[model samples]
Target: MSSRIIAAAVAVAAGLALAVGGAATLVSLARPDRGIDLQNAPAGNGVDGGVVDYGTK
Candidate 1:
């Protein structure tokens, strides 16, 4: 096949790959899997103890 035809095919394949990946990511993130419950989360986990301390006592 010609160089132009090959390049076009490669570009189309790359675009499809990107579209599929992005759609999958979006679908996974959109799923209502009853994620972390802030209202019922453990208290005093040192979340606000200090800056960037994050769950550390």
Candidate 2:
């Protein structure tokens, strides 16, 4: 009986830890813009910018 109780407690703790970690990961990924805001980003011109530039000018 005592061994069963200890096993149950350990299982519950492990499940709670997994749930919290998963929630944290999802929350960190909640923002779409965040995925783009990396420290070292690429510097490239827009693909359709030439069309807009000539048209507007």
Candidate 3:
């Protein structure tokens, strides 16, 4: 293939890769499986039915 075609293919691949990566990252970040994010929400219930501190003391 020509250099221009190859470069265009590479640019398209890179854009697609970046788009997919960004989507995956957003999905992963949107999950609510945190292990006690209690700093901002200190009054919430905890593992043992108590309050938890996320090291903000």
Candidate 4:
């Protein structure tokens, strides 16, 4: 029926939208806005300076 065809088209469109949105979100999260200036920046405890270090149990 026509109604069934319309419903199927809507579902496919919605799925494509969600897939594009998810891809955009992951791409955004993968890149940094500002570049890190490690050479100019002072080092205190390296990358994990304040982070707690778990020694051998």
Q: What is the TM-score of each predicted model, taking all chains together?
A: 0.45, 0.44, 0.52, 0.50
Off by over 4 Å in 1: 34-57
Worst 10 residues of 2 by lDDT: 48-57
The CA lDDT at 14 in model 1 is 96
Candidate 1 residue lDDT tens string, 10-51: 999999999999999999998865654555645575564534
- Error at 8, model 1, angstroms: 0.8
Q: Against the hidden true structure, what lDDT does model 4 obtain?
A: 0.81
Distance from true location, Cα of 33 in model 2, Å: 4.7
lDDT of 2 by residue, 1-57 (tens): 999999999999999999999999999978668556875455458733433245553
Superpose all Cα atoms of candidate 2 onto the true structure and report the RMSD in Å to 1 decimal: 12.0
Better of 2 and 4 by lDDT: 4
Q: What's the residue-level lDDT of 56 in candidate 2?
A: 50
Q: Pick the candidate with the highest lDDT.
A: 3
lDDT of 1: 0.79
After superposing all C-alphas onto the true structure, candidate 3 shows an RMSD in angstroms of 8.0
Candidate 2: clashing pairs of residues = none
Sliding window of 10 residues with minimal summed lDDT for model 1: 45-54
